[model samples]
Target chain A: MPVVGMVGGGQLARMTAAAAVGLGATFRVLAESANESAALVTHDVAIGSHLSLPDIAAFAAECDVITFDHEHVPGAILAELESAGVLVRPGSAALGYTQNKLAMRERLSSLGVPCPRFAPVVSVADVEKFAAGSWPVVLKAVRGGYDGKGVWVCDSAVEAAEVISHGIPLLAEEFVPFRRELAALVAMSPSGQGAAYPVVQTIQVDGICREVIAPAPGLDPDLAIEAEAMALGIAAQLGVTGLLAVELFETRAGGLLANELAMRPHNSGHWTIEGAVTSQFEQHLRAVLDLPLGSCVPAGTFTVMANLLGGTDPDVFDRYIHVMAADPTVKVHFYGKEVRQGRKIGHVTIVGGPGDSVESLRDRARRAASYLRWGTEDGE
Target chain B: MPVVGMVGGGQLARMTAAAAVGLGATFRVLAESANESAALVTHDVAIGSHLSLPDIAAFAAECDVITFDHEHVPGAILAELESAGVLVRPGSAALGYTQNKLAMRERLSSLGVPCPRFAPVVSVADVEKFAAGSWPVVLKAVRGGYDGKGVWVCDSAVEAAEVISHGIPLLAEEFVPFRRELAALVAMSPSGQGAAYPVVQTIQVDGICREVIAPAPGLDPDLAIEAEAMALGIAAQLGVTGLLAVELFETRAGGLLANELAMRPHNSGHWTIEGAVTSQFEQHLRAVLDLPLGSCVPAGTFTVMANLLGGTDPDVFDRYIHVMAADPTVKVHFYGKEVRQGRKIGHVTIVGGPGDSVESLRDRARRAASYLRWGTEDGE
Candidate 1:
């Protein structure tokens, strides 16, 4: 029975807490506020900032190992804790790549991993040089970017310059025309064991993930194996101890390129809660505890997950009963966060059996999610 | 979302709390102690006795609807709460039959349900008369008994007198020469909607449930349907809301007979956690909340659930890592309770897909459970 301390209390921590209950593990989370998603449902929560070294250190003291819900803790703080002999999974050196896009790109590129051509942009001149090869370049913050925030697709140098004017550390990458977004979610143990879930296709709306389809329908078998291998390789190379979600771009040319890296459980793997034999949350705990990883086999032929983003209605539960009645098979997950427009309040997932149409599953998931958000069968 | 308050915070409440996290509902538990299984992991817990009327009242005040983890709550207490306008699912009237075996047998027999011939035993003469047609008879306490407690198989009038002399309100039943024990688990909403899970055969050791096999292998399809219909009819007839697990006796002649009833989540339905599309815990919550009951379809063709009773080892986690590695597909659920010999510490379940043998699944589940209880796979 190990005590796993998770930093940054959010939905990931909330779901992980639920998963930990089955494993007979004591899970503790450090939240910035008592009202955070994880704090609302879990018993052991320390109200503190991830940014404060003292808060993290105090929180880490009681746990056998410390993991993260989000990789937002300053690297210096993580490094300090490690130096003081605290067992931090996905330690500072590996976390640096996820915390900084520029570092991730450089490391992946050096490791011969397929990744977008990118460069650090300290000034507008750098952005201009990077975008010279392509008119519409993707500009990403070097740090503190999530859920489509701090990211800008610049059509021209003028747009890139305007974004850089905010004085945030930025990076410029050549925007590739991709067929669709894919995610390779893998977990690694300190014992060097790694397990990869089936690669899944993630649908993005305005850069925020809206839906996810497991096993990436009609994905080339060879390509799927390659993606899984690449993720496991990246996890091993980066010394990642827990879950690593490698977001990829499935290029139109039938090639794959790494897009982003998440050192903790990512939104893309949320479908695994019902789709895979071992959910990412549970896998993360096994990895962090240095225990053997569970099976990553798919439980169904196809599974679709739809994010329940808050809409005009701040009451997410207003149509919950209707949604449950409409689709009894759809599994709903709420984060216990107050609903605000465009915020990810919860998600819905539907696991399809053999001969079950993926479109039908996706439609059911979406319909339920929409009804919860808009109180209508459709999102009208 | 509605708040669900469950009295008696054992493993059942602990598991229901885990399921509650996904439904966006607030779950609070009334536990006899702060360290009860459910109280340890759940955020909202009232460390109070279910027997205390004031404690139950206070706990029920915060909940939209109240349910039970166990049937130990007094009928008078529940009646008092109901009279005061507190919403209690599986109201006292329905729970009465479950609490008192004699009442259950009498009601089921009157409802035309097949049951063992029985008579209330007020004295040794009463037991002698009931056992006049048979040498061996079954004796059960009318109330406050669980597992093997308050139950006995009496041989001859001498043994019957010993049991009846205890004078704790007893009932005499003709010994059922059954092939195996089966349980029909079903859930009913307050709106009268009902859902029945596949009939499962339960294996008991020393009158304690040891393992459960979903769908009762080799069972006649018609009989399965009949069992389900009978359970549903009983649920409606008794006005039982939430979950009703009807323990049944399948005679050597293929006839089914009612054995016992549990108005709350029962051990026989624990396999539903991983074996069914909607777990019993989640279904109980939905039914008590008056929401539409989720589908009761089996997630896999066959599932084997093996209870992990504490053995010589008080340290249950000693071999947990080994068990996880041995059977990655086996799902483990542990109650946050200290291990004591013969106490139920946890359970391990394995779901079988098409072409998977029930024997193999049962063996795997048993091996994992034994390993968790003892340090060795064979419980050596």
Candidate 2:
């Protein structure tokens, strides 16, 4: 069995571990803690921080192909590894653009990919001018942001100034009114056999994805096709291996713009586990290991995945009973995480349609997830 | 948080670890080896063997409930624990009848539950008398039977006599020319609440289950209702805690006969992991711990579960690509067991239809499991 080394140890790495088992592949995990990564499920666990060069060198030496749980590894080290003959999927040069939001915008723009008008903001003055053109401007941290963190929306100069801190370069962008948030997930094989799942609508709450609806309800077939094509084109152009999640904005103005790029598995593709024939996790293993890519097609007309956020209450087991008994169709997946406020504790994926409609499925998924967090019988 | 002590260590325990995490239940695994049971996932490995009563007592001392990863534990030891004031779910008395086929038959006869007529034959002469009443007899070893082992079908008096002498005292039954095989999966709580998944048709080949079609496709509605009722009655009467799989033979004579019983998580119920709202693992945890039982309604009218037999091929990974790419709708699960011929390695579940008709589901399910094994494009 080929050994696949992963950079970060999170749920994505955990899922990859599940996929690797099916393929009879080995996973070499580099987690900060013993229980942080899916390492417990697999063969080898390397306990260390991602920043340590010797730790990474030891991890790299034991694996056949190297991949990422998240794209946070320093580019210099990756480049050094590459020069020293280590195989890195989505090699360092392409990964650099994704690691830094500023570099991402510049590269995508140069490649003629559609994106929102944006400007770098090191100070309040930069935000003041951007917000003046549009009623609301989006302020984003240049690096390290997830789940609505380090992001702000400014209706005017005052709001944007609140987030502008000393010495940190931020970016301000036109806050385009969007019809829905969509994601086009593609697995680009080492040989470049690109496979794309149907465009899915991702519901965001406080900037963190709360739910994902596959086939993006009410989406035009042509628009979805275009989005998928764009995702494939971007992955192939970048010569990327493994999964690439192209997060998009389906603007009310009638065009899909690239919102962001994720080099590893993303929350929006969770529905694929139940709704697609081949899960993104399985396809990622196939791609990074340079094996034949599995099919990426929707199995159901509609699939809904709701994120389980650890809410205010500490003991949610009481609520899980209510959620499970409420519906027989929704599938719940809870991570082995100690519950904390607003943390992604788990998720529920529901697939229906052609037989069961989108509304019923969505309601069931929403009710199941909400019940887990808040024990609401009447809410949905 | 109550602690549940488990015997043995394997994938079933690994999945149970995932469920116990959500419920905040602690599992103290008494495994034969390190990192063998689901307790390994939670790092709750108790390094000891079920054979060692001293070590077993120490494990039992920590847990509030005693359960099992398998049904191989000595019945005498179990009775001793119950005598010593340990709370063992489905105590030795209940499990003894299940562990021994002869005892099970005698108990079922006394209880007047409908079952196949059988005689406990200790020698070839006793088998001759049994064969005279039933020309085709199914012979089974009294203990430790799994995945088509310890079973034989004798069509001739010569074969019957030879078969009986070969094994220890065994149960020989009149073979039922059944229309279809079915399973009544019921979760029996400590409080005696019984939850039943729709009776599902069991697809078999050479005495091994290949697929399970929910609602036992094409059976009369009354028959489906009766199966659930019979399962509930047995669960309640036996005071069986946790889940009980009542495998039944739907005969050509138009009645269901009890075939076998499993007190813990059984292979027949694996479909619930993806096809039902709550998995059997979750339900088992809830029931054994005396929590409220969840609804047992089918997720769809048709949820088919197919078992994957370990094959002799070295290129096993290719089979994954063929099945996953061919049918994204089919749910596949592998146990991460080292492969060998004719082994119950894993299973695939495919759910279909308009949420009605058991036969339709059975057909779909049969095709999913068979396709994986045979690598065919045509579904059952």
Candidate 3:
């Protein structure tokens, strides 16, 4: 029996626990507390802080391999675990690059990967020189950033100077107007076998993910093929064992430039749960376990996923029935979380076949969220 | 916020927990321990014996409504709970009929429902009377029987005497040479509304379900309609509040006889999880909660399901990758159980459109089980 240990106990860990049920795998979770999320389903739950190495070592001893739900594990501890021979998916060496974008951009550029032109900028002088020829520049912190945080856009150099004093490692690059956003997800086994899911377009609102449309909805065959190729190339080059989600910017010149990367599961690939024959969660587990990959075709011709955000009330979870009663075909997954404003509580996924209208799918997804979060249809 | 309390913690409870997630209902389990059988995903589990009414009440106090995974709840306690206003679904009156075969037969016969002619046989003379014209007769215990247990076939009065002496409240009935076994399931609400799922052919080996063919391949249109009508009639007449599974014995003479009734979700309806527009589990939750019923139309062109039995070795649970790697579309569900011989450990369901061969479907289901249980590709 293989006992798998996970570092975090959030929704990602909750979903992975659900997938682990099929293989009869035992999942041990190191939650921050006894009542933390995902503690309901895991076989063994150890309440401990992430920075406690003894606690992590105790949790890891009960499992054959260790993985992570978030990228907050320090590189020093990861290296210590690796030296002590605990199998870690996405080892510290490969994850270090993505943890800090400055290292990733410089490394990928040297390796001949197509990345946006950028230079390290710690002061106003550095930012002005980088944007001298370019009219607009985007400034980003190399670490501790997610969901559009730690980012600033300057139409001129003066705007960059005000944000430079934050003292985080900064990278300034020329801002290019892109046609659309695309994400390519790749899973590679420890033994070098790999599989790629179809590229999808991500829709964001107020710096939060809202939906994902497979094949970017209207992507040509050539572009789709190119996306898969680029994604697989990065996974193989980085020796990424589990999953790699690379965000791309479709330049006006018809080429894709690397925008960002997530070394673990990302919001862009959530559609794979219902759309693909093999879900990304299953694929990631198989890859890390050194097992064979499954098929990677969409379960239906078209699929759309909408995230469920937490509502204002503390009892927002009571609205789940109203949504499920209206549309039984919609698949809803809820994370057992305390509700507050703007927190991701769950998601609804609906798959439609070829020629299915996007508006109808979108309506169903939104209605499901509305019904589950706020009881908008309660009186009716 | 409906907190539903379930008496038995098993696979059925596990599935009910899955459905409760979608409906935003909470589930509390009364089992021997937190890991008795269904501690994987329940809301809160009370560790105590079900026979202890105080323990049961303590569990029920946290629930607004009470239900059961199996028909093993004591009638007296249920009556007590009913008197206390706990809202026991299917109520004690309805459940008592299904709890005892003798009572079920008598009620069905009085209601003009089609059933095999039977007679209570306390002595060999009674068996001789019933077997005078019939060469063979079926003898069954009145209660506490399932999965080929407590049933026997007698070709002579002497044989019948030996079997009937095994228990009190036994009966003898004329045996029917049935062409096949079929099941019709219906979900009825407290408001008198009911929905019927498609009739499915049940393949039994040694009285255990092996595979189920949804819509009962090659069934006549009239017969199919009649099956649905009969199921609805039975459910409405019985005032069933959740699922009612009617097991039918189809005689060679083209007639149907009632074999048994299950007042909750049955194995035959497992195919609906992935094959129908709405799964039976979700429908059951809706009906019991008095929510609107969903359409019972088949989602794909066909659906097939097979049960997976656990073997002796406990380590056999780690074969998740082999089965998934073989066919990712084959949905396998496992009940977190310690392996036991001949025990129903889990099941696999397959859904596809027309042109999928029955042999292939059967092979896929069996192969998944074989892979999970023995780590062998014998079925493949």
Candidate 4:
């Protein structure tokens, strides 16, 4: 059996481990602690930090291919593994683009990909200069930021300078006044075969993904095709060997501007678990293994996925029985984590048939997710 | 986390472990060896035989509820566990019917469920007498027989006498010349709620289930409804708390006769893994855990599942890439076992769309299974 080593032990890795079992592939996870979601279920877990070179080397020694559950692993460590012939997928070069916002902007812009105009900033002066063309610019940390962290919207140079006192490497970009956010996910094998999932409308609140609807209901056929083509183009250009999520701004003017990039399984694709011909997690495993990719066609007419953020309820398991009994069609996924306010503990997916309304699917998923989080059917 | 301890470590337990992860439930398996299929993937494995009383006790103590992967766990041991207050789903009384074919036949007959005429025999003379009425009788060992083992079809008293010399507890039954074999799978909860899956046609090769087609193509609608009703009635009567697979023979006269019973996940329902809204393995977990059972509605227009029996090839992983590439929609499941001649190593399932032909679906599943078993697309 070929061993696939994952560098993180989050819910993404937990799901990947489940998919690995079906593939008859041995899965190993390097966890910072035994309590991480994936570590709790995976059989082979190495308790180590991603920052430790020796830990990375030890974990890589046992795997036929090394991949990641998150892109937080330093680029130097991944580069080291690659030099040692460890077969790190979505290799360090591709990860470098996702790891740093400025690098991704530069690369995509240079490739003539549609993207928000951006420039690396040393001080507020640079931000002011960039804002000369577009006011109310968005300033984001170059690296090590996620879920609303390390990002700020500044209307003027003084406001941007005050926020920059945190001393983080910053990049300024044109604030996209988009009608909605969409994500196009694609999986590519090392052998150059790629498969694209339908473009999905992603709802984000406080920079945390709240829900996703597949195929972006009523999306223009031409724009959907263009988004998929753009995502595929980026994956090819980056030589990304697993799932690549291109978060885009669907501007009111009917054009797409690249917003962000994620090179692993993304929250926007969670609906694929039950709604698509092949799940993104399964496709990622196949891609990293250089195996033939599975079909990415939608299995149902519509799919709605809602994240279950941790609320006051400490025991989500108690609510499972109720949620399941309420809607037998809703698929529930729980990430084994201690309940902390606003943390993502799990998600619910509801797939609708051709005759079913998307509004009903979305309501059912949201209701199920709310019940799980609050232990009430009214979905407060 | 509530721990579910399973008493056997076959593919049934392996699939259940995967489902348990989705439920955020802790799954523990008591395996006879470390090399059992479920033992390889499951994290909490007790390497002890189910036959050992102390081992069963130790395993049961760690679990909130107990179940079985196979019906081979001795009834007395289960009774002892029950006496000790360990919760065992489908309790010892229910498993008793499945463990002893004569017991199942007797119970079904007394309950007025249709079944073949059967009699327990102690000697060759008794077998000879039973065969006198039927001409050709099927003799089966009363216990510990599976996959065509311990079964013999004797045409005459002389042949019956020769086969009975094997010295196993035997039962003789009238051989029903049937049109085909069918299975009705139902999931029941301790609360008396029951859900039935679609009746399926099962193809048996040498008593081993080789293929199964859901909703039994060309099956009479009335007969299908009757089969489901019978299965649900049997589950409620037997007090079976998990999955009950009631294998039946559709007589040449269009009547249905009970053929066999399995008190756990059965091979015939494997198609539900991808073909139905809820998989049998997931439903089993829900039923055993006393949670609400999921929907049993089929997810596709049709589904065909084919077992991948081990052939001359020892390396199944090598053929997986080809099988997956050949048919991306075929869901492959490997038992993670070394290949041996005629052993069931894995299975493949294919779901058809609204416009797809069942024949094409069956052909695709068979070709995938054959390629996995023999590395040939022509299924030779």
Interface Cα root-mean-square deviation for all models = 0.8, 5.0, 3.6, 1.1
Native interface contacts retained, candidate 3: 0.31
Predicted candidate 3 versus true structure: per-residue lDDT over B1-380, tens digit per residue: 56777788877877776566544455677777777557665647777776777877888888877777888888898889888778889888889977888888998898888899898888888888888867699988888879988788888877887886776778777788899999999999898878999999998888899889887888777777777888888887777888999999778987788888999889999888667756787788778777667668776667889888776566654576567667857777778777787788888888765668777877788888777767776732
Ranking by DockQ: 1, 4, 3, 2
lDDT of 2 by residue, A1-380 (tens): 47888887777776666555444466677888877735444446777778777778788998888888888888888988898899998788878778788888888888899999888987777777666666688988788877777678877777776788545678877887898899999988877778889899998988989889988988899999999998898898877888899999999988999999998888998888767757787788778887667656665678899998887787877787566556645666766567887788888887775668888887788888777877674443
- List clash counts for every candidate, in order: 0, 8, 1, 0
Per-residue CA lDDT of candidate 4, range A1-380, in tens? 68889999999999888888788888899999999999988878999999998999999999999899999989998888888888999899999998999989989988889998888888888888888856798999999888888888898877898878889899988898999999999999999999999999999999999999997999999999999999999999999999999999999898999999999999999999888888898899999998899999888889999999998879877788889988888888888889988999988888788888989998898899888888875654
Off by over 4 Å in 3: A40-43, A317-319, A371-380, B18-24, B40-43, B191-193, B253-255, B289-299, B311-321, B353-355, B371-380
When summed lDDT is taken over every stretch of 10 residues in candidate 4 chain B, the lowest stretch is B127-136
The 10-residue segment of model 3 chain B with minimum total lDDT is: B18-27
Q: Clashing residue pairs, candidate 2? A: A277-B328, B13-B38, B14-B38, B217-B358, B217-B359, B218-B359, B301-B355, B367-B380
Strongest candidate by lDDT? 1
Clashing pairs in 4: none
Question: How do the residues A236-343 of candidate 3 rate in per-residue lDDT, one tens digit apiece?
Answer: 888788888889887888888888877777778777766776677667777777767766777676678888887777676446655655775687776767787778
Q: For residues B1-380, could you state the per-residue lDDT of candidate 4 as single tens digits?
A: 57888999999999988887777888999998998999888878998988988999999999999999999889998899899999999899999998898888899999999998899987878987776756789998889888888788888887888877888888999999999999999999998778999999999998899999997999999999999999999999999999999999999999999988999999999999888889899899989988889999888889999999998979887789888888888889888888998899989888788988989998898898888888887763
True contacts kept of each: 0.88, 0.12, 0.31, 0.65
Per-model B-chain TM-score: 0.98, 0.90, 0.95, 0.97
Quality class of the docking in candidate 4, CAPRI style: medium
In terms of DockQ, the best-performing candidate is 1
Q: What TM-score, over all chains together, does every model reach?
A: 0.98, 0.87, 0.92, 0.98
Candidate 1 per-residue lDDT, tens place, B1-380, comes to 88999999899999999999998889999999988999989999998988999999999999999999999889999999999999999899999898888888889999999999888888878888887757799889988888888889988888888887787999888888999999999999989999999999999999899999998999999989999999999999999999999999999999899888998888999998878889999999999999888988888889999999988877667588888988889889999889899899888888888979999998898889888887777872
- The candidate 3 chain A region of ten consecutive residues with least summed lDDT is A371-380
